[model samples]
Target chain A: MAEKPKAFGERYMVKPGKSFRLADCDPRAANGFSDKDAAKADTVRDAAAIDALQDKLYAEGKRALLVILQGIDCSGKDGTVRAVFNHCGPIGVKVQPFKAPTADELAQDYLWRVHHACPPRGFIGIFNRSHYEDVLVVKVRGYAPPEAIEKRYDEINAFEKMLSDNGTKILKFMLNISKDEQAERLTERIEIPEKRWKFNPSDLEDRALWNDYMKAYEVALTRCSTHHAPWYVIPADRNWVRNAAISRIVRETLEEMNPKYPEPKGWDPKTVKVV
Target chain B: MAEKPKAFGERYMVKPGKSFRLADCDPRAANGFSDKDAAKADTVRDAAAIDALQDKLYAEGKRALLVILQGIDCSGKDGTVRAVFNHCGPIGVKVQPFKAPTADELAQDYLWRVHHACPPRGFIGIFNRSHYEDVLVVKVRGYAPPEAIEKRYDEINAFEKMLSDNGTKILKFMLNISKDEQAERLTERIEIPEKRWKFNPSDLEDRALWNDYMKAYEVALTRCSTHHAPWYVIPADRNWVRNAAISRIVRETLEEMNPKYPEPKGWDPKTVKVV
Candidate 1:
C-alpha cells in the first residue's frame, strides 16, 4: 500500500514556541496538490468523511469541536464553510457569524458573546469571525488602549486552554489571500449584479490599511497559536485549494478524536421488550 | 401546458377555524404517491431545491423561515431534518432542539427561550421540538395548572403571529406516527448498539401516555394553527413519505417567499474600481 498522505493539520499548523512571520507563507500555495480538479474531488470526499465522523460525535454526545475562521474581507470564510461542512447535517453542525457587537454585548468583556456562542458537547460550532477580532480589529483601529490590547493574547490562550481541558477541541483558520486576489474579488463583487449586495464601501477603507491588518494578524497568530488551539494560515487565493486544505484538516482532526456510540449501562436488548 | 401539482403545504395544512381530528389522518399515508422509491427520489430533488432557495434567502437578508417540529418519542423528528435539510449549507440553516427547560428558562415565560431561538432574517431556524412542548408534555404531565395551560394556545398563536408580522414565516409540523410504529422503532433502538444511546427508558413512560399526548396534540393543533403559522400533520410512520411531503412543503413555501438579491443603491458598478 502507498504511504499515507501527511495530514493538513500538521502541515499548515502554526507551531507553538517557534519564530513565525505571515510574509513567510505563500497565500497561493497549493499545499502539495498540483491539480485543482483532483483537489476539489478530494475535498468532497473529505467532507463526506467529516459528516460520518460527526454522526459518531453526535451519538457519543461527550465532546465538541469549535472551528474558528478569521480573515480579511473576501477571503472566503463563508465559502470555505459551505464547501467543507455542506455534507454535515444541520442537526450536528452550527455556524455562528460574529458581526458588530450589540450594546448588550459591548457592555461585557469581549469574550462574553463568543463564549455563549460556543458549541455545547456533541456539536461542531464554526465561528465565521471570532474573539480574535478583539486583537486584530481593536489593535488595528485602536479601539482599545495599546496596553489593554497587548494583554489579550495571554487571556485568549488561557481561555482556550480551559475549553481544551473541558473536552472542546478548537481549530482556527486564518484564510491568507494575496492583496491582488482580494482586489479581484472586490472588483467582481462590484461588477456582478447578484454579488453587488455584498460589496461594502467601508471595506475599501480597511483595504488601504492592509499592511496594518497583516501585522496585527501576525502578532495574534504567533502569540495565541498554543498547543490547545493552533491556527492554520490557509492559502486562500484559490477557493479550491482553501476548501481542500481546511476540509482535510477538519476530517483528520475528527478522526483523531474518534467519538464512539456509548453502550447502555446494565440493559440487555434481548430482555427489553416494548409493550 | 401542464398544470402544476398542488403544493403539499395546502394539501396537508390543518386549516384554521376548522374542526380537526388527529385520528382522521393516516400515519402511513403517502399523500398522493404510491411508489416509495419514486417518492424518495422526488424528496432528494426537493431537498436540493430547498438548498438553492435558501441561498437566495440568505442573500436577500430581509426575511426568515422558522420550522417547528413537534412529535412524540420515535416519531422521526431528527430523521426528517437530516433528510430534508442535508443539502442546505450550515451558513443558512440552524437546528435548535428544545429539551426540558433549564432553571433560568423556567424563570421566564415559556415563550421567552423560543423567541430568543427564532432565526434572524435571512436564515432558517428549525426547532426539533418547540414551545408546543409547553402544551404537549406540560399538559400531559400536569406540569402546569389547567388555567395556565388553557391560555398558552392563544399566547402561542399571538407569539407566532408577531414573528410572522416581523418577516419570519412559520411552518409547524406534527410528525404523526402509529402506536405500532413507535413500538417497532423503540425496539430497534434497544437492539441496535449504535442507536442504544438514544433509547431512554423514560420514552416508554411517555409511550404509555400515548392517548393523552394525542389528545393534547389535537387540542394544540386545533387551537393554535393560524393563518400566519399553519400546522401540517405529516404522516411520519413511513420515513420516505414523511421526508418527501415535508420537503415539498418547505420548498414551495420558500419559492412563494420569493426572496431576491437586493439592488445596490447610490453606487454604480461601472463607476467603482478596485484599488
Candidate 2:
C-alpha cells in the first residue's frame, strides 16, 4: 500500500464519456503561467528529472512508457520533443515519427505499424504522430468510409487498452494549436531559411480544412480517452507553455510509476570480489 | 572525382576470396597503441564527431548504417555501444539486440525479423547480435545439417549484397577475445556486484566448445566477407582498445558518407515573409 496512486493529468485530461468540444479548450491558455522565461526554466528541470527517472525504468526492465503526440501541421510536435527530451539519453528512448502509410503499411491493418513500434520493455517511445491519425486525418479526408471510420474509435481504444494491460503506460497529448497560431508558424517555416525545408505546400490543404480536423480531433479525444490511456489536450500556442505542461505531466507520471533497479539474485555482494 | 574513396578499415577487414584463419588474429593485440588512457581519449573525441555527423545524416535521410556485433558471452558488446555512442542522440540511432529467436520469429525465415528491424533511411542501426548467429551457433551446436549450414554462408552474402544495393552500408565486427580473457571476464561477471545479473550458467556450456566455435567463425568469415558488407575482427581483450578502434572506423565511415542538409524545393526564403 506504499505505492502512489496512478498518475493522471486532471488539468487537461479529456474525461471519458464527457461532452467534449475542441472549441471549449483555449489553445493559447498558459495554465496560469504569466512568465514565459519562468515556464521555460521549469521545463528544463522537468526534462532532467525525466532523464534520471528513465534510467531507473530501464534498469528495472519491467515496463514501458509510450508517449503519443498528435497535432495538426505547425503545431510543434518536433519542437516539443527537442525541448522535453533534450537531456534524456538516446539509449532508452525511441522517437517514431509516423508519416503517410507506405504501400506495405497500407496492406496491413491500421495498427500494425503502431503495435510494432510500441516501446519494448524498459524503454520510452515517443510517437510524433500516432494511431489517432487513423481516426483524425483519415476521418477528415474520408480515406475510409463513414462506417469504417466509426469502427476505428473503439478499435483504437481496445488496441491501446491491450497495450496498457501488457505493461505499457500510455500518455496521449493533443497539441491543440489555434488556427491563427498555426498560420503564423507555417509562414515562419517558409520565411526562415533553416526551416524552409519543412514547409510543404500540402500542409496548406490541411490548413484549409482546419475546422473539419478540429471536429475529428474532438471525437478522437473524447472516445479514446479511457482510464488506462488518457488524452491531454496541451495548449501549444506558446512553445514554452507546451513544453512546460507536457514535461511536468510526463515527469510526474514517471515519478508515480517509481521504477526501482532490481537486486541481483543468487549472488552475495559481500562475498563476491572481481579478481 | 572530388569525392574521397569509400572508407574501409584496412587494419581489420577480412579480405574476400583470400585464405583466412581466425587463429592468425591475436585477441590481445593492441593495434600499435600502447597507452590505454590515450586510446580512451580518442574514443571520446570520435564519439562527439559521430554525434555531429549523425545530425547531418538524419537531415539528409538518404541511407542507413547497420553495425553488427558478434562475440561469445562476456565479450563487451554492450560496453562498446556505451563507449562509442555516448554522445549520439537516440533520434537517429537504434540498437536492436537479438537474443534467441522466439516462436513467432522461428515461424519465418531467419532473416525475416532482421529485415523488419533494418534501420530506415538516415539512421544508424546497431545489432548487438545478428543473422550471423544462424551460421555460427547453429553450425557449432549441430542444430542443422552440414549441407544446410554450408548454404547459409552464400545465402547471407547474397542477402547482404541486396541490402548494400539498396543503400544500407553494413559493418560486421567479431569481438575476438582470448580463451583466457573470456575466462577472466566470465569470472568477473560472477564476482562483480553490478555485473552479477549478466552471469548465466549456460555461458559455461558454450565456453566448453570454444575450439569448435573458432573453426565455425573461420569458415563463415572467409566465405561471407564481401565487397559490399565487410567483416572486421576486433581484439577485445582490452576495453579501451576495442572502443577506440571501432569508434575510429565508424567515424571514418560516416565522414566518407558526408551527408548534407538537403535544399528546399519550390520555396524561396528570400521572398517569403511571415505575416
Candidate 3:
C-alpha cells in the first residue's frame, strides 16, 4: 500500500472507505512536534494568517467554510474555537452550537436544522456539535432503530457532498482525548471548587459509555471520510499541539482555496464621481 | 459636609440626583497606580479570585450579579469582558450584547426584554449595552416623546429596585472615553483591513452626535445612579486601568456577597455504605 500521509493535516485526515480504527491512533502524537511553546507561537502566527484569509473570504463573498467540531465530553471543543479563531473578528465568524433538538427542530427531518445552521457565503460557521450526533449519540443511546441509524452514514455523506458541490468547504474534527485524559479532566472539574459549575453527575454516566462512544466514533470517522468532505481525527490530549495542528491545516486550506475580492464590472474607482 | 469617599470604588461612583458631567472626569486617572503591567497582573490575579467567588455563587444558587456595560462605540466593552472574565469558566458568566432591538423586542415595554435577559441565580450576566439605551439613545434620537422619555428614568429605577428586592445585584459602568480617543479607535478600525468588517459607515453617523450623547449620558448617570443600581464612570481610555478598576470592584462586590456552598441536608459521609 502507498505510505500514509503524515503531516499536520494529511496525517489526521481519515482515508476514504478503508478499514480504519480510531484506537490505532495515539492521542499523544504531536505530529513530529515536541516543543509546546514553539507550537503556541506558531499557532498565534497562523491565527493572524487566518485573519487575513478570513478578510479575503469576506471580501470575495462567494464561498463559505463550515468547521464541524465533534467530540466526546471534556474534549476541549470550545477552547479550540477561542484559541484558533481569537484573532478573527466576531462578525466574520459565527459559532452555532448544536444542542439537543428543540420542538421546532424535532418537527422536521434530522438534517433540516443542520441545513439552516450552515455558514452563509463569506462567513465561517463552527458547529460545536453537529449532524453527526444522529449517528454517534443517537445510535449509542438507541434514540433510533439500529437500521435507521445505520443509514445515516450514507445520508451524512450525501449531505456533506451537497454542501461541497455548493460553495461550502467543510472540515470536520473529532477532538480525540484518551479515556484516562478524560478521567483527569473530570476529576479536576470535581475536585476544584472553581470548576464545579462545569461538572455534571450525568457526565459520569457518559464516561461509563466510553468504549461504546469510541466504537461509534470509529465507525463514523471511517464511513464518512470522503473527497467532498473529510473528517480529521485530531489528537487533543495536549491543547497546544491540537491548536497548532488544526490552525496549520485551516490556514493551509484557505491558502489553497485562494479567494479574492471581486472588482465591479467594467468600472474604475477614478472614473466614479461623488455628488 | 461629609468626607468624599475616594477609594477606587467610590471615586468613580456616580452620586444619585447630583449634577454630573462626564467631561469633568479625566479618562487618564489610574487611581494612583502608575504601572500598567502591574495592573494587568493584578487584574488576572483577581480574575482567579472572581472565579472562586463564582464557584460559591453557583453552589449557593440563590443570587445573581448583573454587570451593565454601556459606552460609546470603540470604548472597549468587549475587550473589558475578555480581560476581566477570561479566567472565569464560560458556564459561570454569560455575556448578552443588546444590539438594536429586534421587531419582537420593540413591540414590548423596553424593560421586558432586558428583564428576560437578566442573569439567573448563580450566573454572572454581563450586558454589553443595556436598557439604559432607552434613556441614552431614545432621548438623544427623539425615539420617544419628550414627556415619555422623561418618565423612563423613574420607571427604570423602580424596575431595578424590584430586581434588587428579588435576588439580583446590579453594577453599571459607563466606559468613559474622550472624543480624541474615540477618533483614534475609529480610524484604526477603518485603516486595518482585517478589522474593516467592524467598521460601519453608519458608525460615523453616531459619532456626529457626540455632544448630544455626552449630555444624555450626564442626565441618565445622575438620575439613575440609585442605591439599587449605581453607575460608575470608569476612565476607559487606558485599557489596562479600565480592566484593573473594574476587576477590583467586581472582586470586591463578590467578596461582599459571600456566597457559600450548601452542605447536603441530612447526608453525612461517615454512614454511607459503598455498593
Instruction: Give the candidate number with the greatest lDDT.
Output: 1
lDDT value for model 1? 0.90
Task: Give lDDT tens digits, candidate 2, residues B110-212.
Answer: 8899999999898999998899899988888887788987888999988998888898988899999999998888888776555665766667778989998
Model 3 lDDT tens row, B68-137: 9999999999788877875663556766778889999999998999999898898888898999999988
Worst 10 residues of 1 chain B by lDDT: B1-10
Task: For model 2, report the TM-score of its A chain.
Answer: 0.96
TM-score of chain B taken alone, every candidate: 0.96, 0.95, 0.96
Off-target runs (Cα >4 Å) in candidate 3 are: A1-7, A16-19, A44-67, A78-128, A154-170, A183-205, A226-229, A251-275, B1-7, B17-19, B47-64, B86-94, B112-123, B162-168, B187-201, B258-275
RMSD per candidate (Å) reads 3.6, 4.4, 5.6
Local error of candidate 3 at residue B205 (angstroms): 3.8
- The fraction of correct interface contacts reproduced by each prediction comes to 0.86, 0.32, 0.01
List the global CA lDDT of all models: 0.90, 0.85, 0.83
Colliding pairs, model 2: none
TM-score, prediction 2: 0.81
Candidate with top DockQ is: 1
Q: Write the per-residue lDDT of candidate 1 for residues B124-205, one digit (tens) a residue.
A: 9999999999999999999999999999988998898899989998999999999999999999999988889888888888
Q: Write the per-residue lDDT of candidate 1 for residues A128-241, one digit (tens) a residue.
A: 999999998888888899999989999999999999889899999999999999999999999888899888887888899999999999999999988778889999999999
DockQ of 2: 0.26
